[model samples]
Target: MSVILESKSSRVCINEKGAEVCSFVLKETNLEYIWQADETYWARHAPVLFPFVGKLKGDSYTYNNESYTMNQHGFARDMVFIVEHQEKDSATFLLKSSEETLKNYPFHFELRLIYRLVDNDLTIAYQVETQSEEMYFGIGGHPAFNIPLVKGTNFNDYYLHFAPSKSRFLLPLEGAFINLAEKTLAQTNTSIQVERRIFEKDALVLETKGENAFSILSDVTNHGVVVSYDNLPYVGIWSPFPKEAPFVCIEPWAGIADTTDATGKIEDKKGMNLIHPGDVFERSYKISIK
Candidate 1:
């Protein structure tokens, strides 16, 4: 298909069949970590899950009674990512789970993605495997970066930083009708809003504050780009920045979201991940330009 992978300073333009990283061009001179071309990050490398971020509403969800058609972080980025290996900078993409993805995710899977570029940092490795014996899955990373990217950078004089405060903010779940009035898997530290309607008002599920996982969105205030995750549990800071969309999707997830008391078999959904019967799972994340 159209799997273009270039990054030996051709400035990062990866699209291994929606393993998604469509163009991150920064020729030679830089206006900081370029990003701007507006919304489009569906790089679901492994058995799916990651911006399709979090939702369970109408993309259809119900298991056991056998009803599945996941969309919104599950169902793996539209589809197409299987080119086991590549070199010049590093690349590997794959997707497995069928009878058409188990007829909408019933289980039996394999999702692997490994894209690496050294000097300028770009290492995305997400792997998952399970032929059955019990199954459930989650893998993540939706790379997006382009702000003011080139022309007169004015996205609020560019300044996005977060590496200090993290106590609470897992705010966004349109699935079971707003977690059915919050039930308490709880915490508190208000003032959180990052919405862009997709099951309605999406993204803001930051539990355990990523344990210092790493986050720095910049442009002045110390240059930019530094997203590191070798064993991520959760991390996301999306941007349709002030709306009109222009790159900013820093995500890393192992699981979380869609918990209004879930039981949607796929081994009880919610933060899923149950690999057995041939089990295998690996995870990695890193981005450069700082």
Candidate 2:
């Protein structure tokens, strides 16, 4: 099932299965900004990554001296979320850990995703609460939007412009695991043009230090999208390989994937968080369709 939310300038659809945003349409232009989730290139729209983000070494992790198995991005994306509350332009979906989840994650916790629509913008807030004495996990977003948002524009015409920052390099991923081999794309922060081959090595995980927001713009088209990831520690840009896929994902990650030489321990995984009992972790990111 899916829920619909509308604002003066936009309309959105959220699937109850994963609380994933399936659609985001601009009312003024009648254009869809979110991906259509075609199985040919990719099979998902916007999936929430929880408990874990990216791949685990050997597809398993050791927790409390015991091993648990989990795939890339974890199981939250495949679980149903209950509607906690809803209004005309906003909704909240909740997911609590179960025996099924504990078997793989071994932690009691609650995950909530709140969607709010205001004019041409949508904000997604993620909140996690720990019920166990200690919980180790990661959380992130995987939202894909249509590239060349305006018709008649090629994918390569669009580029990502970041806010000013110090020199940085991207940690390239090999089969979704950090390659450890790095390269500096920009010395003083600049726009990185979107090309067909940029994603040949998988998503480029931009180093998070002093980086926050970016705008997806085109040289000829006036239409684009701006993403603001205020507190996120990392951002990922990706698309379907070798197909010149029509959509692009601008991800805001509070945690990241395993490194090439990861030790397979949940606690030692880079970007994983540890939450004390009775504590809450809250973060959010915003998207504006222009």
Tell me the whole-model lDDT of each prediction, alpha carbons only.
Answer: 0.58, 0.87
RMSD of each: 14.5, 1.5
> What is candidate 2's lDDT per residue for 104-173, written digit by digit as tens?
9899999999999999889999999988989988999999989878888988889988876455567778
For candidate 1, write residues 1-290 as lDDT tens digits: 54444555545555555576655444466443534333254322222353234656566666568787777666567677778887777778888777877777676777777878866677778777777776666667656565445465444545444444445445455533235354334232322222343213444445544434444444444445667764666665665423556555667777655666565444565565666877677878777764
Could you tell me the lDDT of residue 13 within candidate 2? 96
- For candidate 2, the TM-score is 0.96
Candidate that would win on TM-score: 2
Residue 47, candidate 1: Cα error in Å is 17
Window of ten residues with lowest summed lDDT in model 1: 190-199
TM-score for each predicted model, relative to the true structure: 0.34, 0.96
lDDT of prediction 1: 0.58
Question: What's the distance in Å from true for residue 78, model 2?
Answer: 0.8
